[model samples]
Target: MRPKDEGACSGDGMAGRIITVAQQKGGSGKTTLTANLAIALRRKGFTVAVLDTDPQGSLGRWFMERLQGVGEDGGLEFSTSSAWGASYEGEKLKRRFDVVLIDTPPKIESDLRPALRVADLVLVPVASSQVDLWATEGVLDLAAREKRPVMIVLNRTRPNTRLGAEVAAGAAALGVDVARAQLAHRVSYAESLGRGGAVAEGPAGPGRDEITALADEIMAQAGIEGAATIR
Candidate 1:
């Protein structure tokens, strides 16, 4: 992918695209996606910043571990904010980064609007389960009200399984755009995050490929041009 021009704006006068990863269901891989996607974007030659709006502070903890392990942030900036402060903090980071990703807490309600309102795109991760699919409604409804574009990502899927097929079909019925790229059940994702790094930093494998594809698709959905081709 070509590097973004320094003066390129998000077309709304913002210097960067703010992508809020939200899901009402807990354990939907919100922080995992945020951390891995941040690393993926950085590798694609885009400066990225991650904003952790969840009170749980999981994303913030991961960044701290990454700092300790690597002794540096690897050009990826990180910060924390309250649910209400997401807009302010995210916008502030946008000025200096190519992408700003907000990792929101579980449970969708009025509190999620502040973050959704400021997003160029809202990414909803739905794990391969009927329960996970059901939990996505509140998030989809909220994003619809905010008029933000949303993409459903199938996460932790078990390929070639009946349950996986069922969940994929169920997600399609929600009338939202489901990403063609899906993240499978992989120990690499969890193990890497435990070390404050991403699967992309490890040897080339399916885990890295899944993240790269999803990142490219997300950039396309956000109307950003020149996403890196899958390696």
Candidate 2:
């Protein structure tokens, strides 16, 4: 189904919301979150696509594994590229799809700049650790300079920990919006994605609730109105 914002034209006159998933730090579950969010949004009856601008191509590999039926129904229909020059195609995909999630490289200077320039919303996934939180500052700085609306999604957060709160506050201090719900450090999230399916498509295991909750918080922050067609 087309997104409700279909009439709104992008900078190139396309109709879609370009959400860039980025963070300067590695191993913070950037690709994992991007992949799952693609599925979550698609399951809600909105057409979704992913643009992997990372040199590592982790998101692209995940898509390949998914197509082989190694994982759950990602519900995303899209492609991956190593550079932003393909953005014309990316914009086309967005117009054809409801939402386009851009998975950017870990560095903010090179590959990420172009995508950020065209993004409607930027989702920076942060892990719960001093090193990760500290590392987030660089990316946040870049986003701030770009003047893009940045929202922090705390990934792999441990419950009842002062670190989580500290991270959230630190992000807010930077004037970045931090989603109230955070993704837990769960084996199910890893295992589900390993099997080529997002947590939403995996068995209703231990981490299912956490993934769904995270999805809900993201939708709220993105200004995605109305009830989602829960899968």
Candidate 3:
């Protein structure tokens, strides 16, 4: 094992709960959600770390920006744990981080398998579109094969659309848990990304509230009581 202290620290002391943010489809907001959720959880006082398993390296750059000009008590930490290197860095860091947020690439590759194999929960971001919904099946099938607790969160959803209902029904039919809160389509999320930090740290606006709500839903699902559990 890596012996911890490699990437970000998730509060609660690495209880073997690895949350993987993944989807077989691109543009599903998997990385975005992973980044923000990690920060939100850290804000809740949990020592959180992010495992940037994707090859695209978007999450890596985001972390670089977040780390710049920041003091030691930064909210979150980021690390790169590829599929082949999973047994090394990931397993080692798990011993230290309270919660590990893993960002997987799009597709069921060898790298994805190792990440999923270690995950306590899998959060899949699904856009409000028929194609994206259909694409979710592949990942869902993989999760089923692994018997992991998978939850779907609607991302960048249009206001008052039937997509939420449809996604809810689809997830229910597949026996996958769906988040109660759907993140609405907002420029703030994108804008925050452009600024290289979390929406919560950015200007106060609707996106911050949405991220907070989503984080609460995730915590509730995980049975986490308060920020104390994280710190």
| Candidate 3 displacement at residue 219 in angstroms | 1.9
Off by over 4 Å in 3: 1-16, 69-75, 162-165, 228-231
- What digit string (tens of lDDT, one per residue) describes model 1 on residues 19-79? 9999988999999999999988877777788999999988988999988997774357888
Name the best candidate (by lDDT): 1
lDDT of each: 0.87, 0.74, 0.73
In model 2, where do residues sit more than 4 Å from their true spots? 1-14, 70-75, 227-231
Of 1 and 2, the candidate ahead on TM-score is 1
Per-residue lDDT of 15-108 in model 2, one digit per residue for the tens? Answer: 7677888888889899899988887776676667788878888887778888888543334665767656535656777665667888888774
TM-score of predicted structure 2 = 0.85
Q: After superposition, how far is residue 169 of candidate 3 from its true place, in Å?
A: 3.8
Candidate 3, residue 171: how far the Cα is off, in Å: 3.6
* Model 1 stretches with alpha carbons more than 4 Å out: 1-14, 227-231
